[model samples]
Target: MEASKRQETARAPALPWTVRFQIFGLVAAASVAQRLNGTVNRSFFSLVDRHVRASARPDKFGVRSDDVDVDASRGLWARVFKPSEAQSPLPVVVYFHGGGFALLSAASVPYDNMCRRFCRELGAVVLSVNYRLAPEHRYPAAYDDGVDVLGYLEKNRLQDPAVQVDLSACFVAGDSAGGNIAHHVAQRWTAAKSKSIRLAGTILVQPFFGGEERTESERRLEGVAPIVNMRRSDWSWRAFLPEGADRNHRAAHLTSENADLAEGFPPAMVVIGGFDPEKDWQRRYADLLQQKGKAVQVVEFPEAIHGFFLFPKLPDAGNLVKEIKAFMDKSKASASSA
Candidate 1:
């Protein structure tokens, strides 16, 4: 949490930068092709199983990555990364990781790197939540976990006086499925009139905000190596939703209402990858907010893909880290002046 430590971590040197992404892609493609006869959902899960096993970053802070289990029914687990120094009431960003809701965890290296960088660069308390996955707990479970974490932070305020977090500057963020959760949480906060916990902004990275239907990119990317396919997306939705429920359930998809996404909704910074299948949805969300007279920054990384933020070796990944830091700093400055 010291300034020096944070600086070092933020600019942490490459660990060989040696991930053989191409080989991994080839292996994944072969696996998918082999399982083509099975349900698309199950085929996708085969790749997920490999990813979960391969991505193993050791726990930092002497805290087990899965230390806090908040609820059983909702399967809420959180990993907290506290800044070394709390000079003032610093910001707190609770992040939800991507993977279509059913295929990732708070412990994944890709997300772990992001959580660390956010904590280091912004000097903010960052908590990565591992909400319940699908096929067991679907639909409302993810949204419920997000809301519960906000309440947990408010309830535990008194216990960490030294770790000063500006309640007004607290934010929730996520990528893809996680992004959907972030949006739902912000809406829930507005509905409850939760004045005790204020959010400065919400950040969505390649957020998925649509139903099973295919966009142009999704159609174009069908069976394309290293790009998301509409078929896979359809499978993910089925896994995320409860039996017999539509993926476009009003509460599940944030694009359904202008009222829930009005100007009072938190100012947002949305980062999209030009080639991501969900690019259209990201654009729509940005335009929707701007039309509503809200402050929104849409940053499109031209050469990146859906999970570019996780690919540290890629130049765009570091660029995004820089971009997010700038947004948080400016917000902090404005909050200070106000």
Candidate 2:
């Protein structure tokens, strides 16, 4: 029996480099800390944060950035990026960063690079929001922060002299958990019937959403994705959601029953990675939006994985940006005609 087990072990396939590195970091953290505790988790993620920050080589070619506090009481802030050469007021993109609702920051290296790219490529002012994270501030806190940032932008546009923003051309965008927040924020904005700023469109990049029932893609890609897996995603849901709430919560998971919330949503661009476990649900949401008569565009990157936008070197990353630009331009034209 032992000899057979050894033979089976030897025949097992090797994990991908990304998975191996992730496991190695977790193992090293456990070994060095002598225990698996919150402190160790934070320490390990901090190292990852540092690494990501280091890799963020800012491309400020045609863009200039500035930091501003949106609401000090709520500890909300944003890093605003504007195209330097644009003489006229440009559209605004209020962006949120993805970290499973518990990790990453708007000021992180990847997010900074993303904001810079959006500013330069779209010729727009990108307001990358820094909302409070969860496990410290639960569910609705992040959602409320998103709405607050929009309100602040609408009311205080003239205060920032660095960039002239066209409120009529405003849009909200985010990746992963940020995408989830953007969805909720758009709903809130539409519900409020605010005429101060019209949301021309929304871009959801690999939005992180799930439900009590497992998705087919989730089952198929359970342990497959290099960075995100079933276990990690489940942990994030538990950590960020309100206590006693399950994945079925409307805010956490978008279902057909509540699809009405998307009825008045601005034109949307839903970007999904084929290899992502969340792909099924993201696609479903896009279809729901389309069915509701909302103008929606679905862009899929068959070779990409979750959070692929962070890696600008990937071919799909540039294509995703171009898709966003096209969507924005279409929305802009529609808004003008309307």
Question: Which candidate number would show the highest lDDT if scored against the true structure?
Answer: 2
Check candidate 1 and list the clashing pairs.
1-84
Residues 212-302, candidate 1, lDDT per residue (tens digit)? 4556656544444243556556666776777776757664454536336633577789998765767776887788778777788899886
Candidate 2 lDDT over residue span 1-338, tens digit each: 97685344233223456655654564344334322232225565656564232222334385667778888887888888876545678999999898778777877777887788888888888889899987778889999999999888888984545457899999999999999999999989988888889999999999888888888777766656556767666667777787878888887777678756634579889998877888888988888787777888889887677877777756788998899999999999999998
User: Residue-pair clashes per candidate, as listed?
Assistant: 1, 0
Q: Model 2, residue 38: displacement in angstroms? A: 7.9
lDDT of 1: 0.69
Off by over 4 Å in 2: 1-40, 51-60, 158-162
Worst 10 residues of 2 by lDDT: 31-40
Residue 84 in model 1: shift from native, Å? 2.9
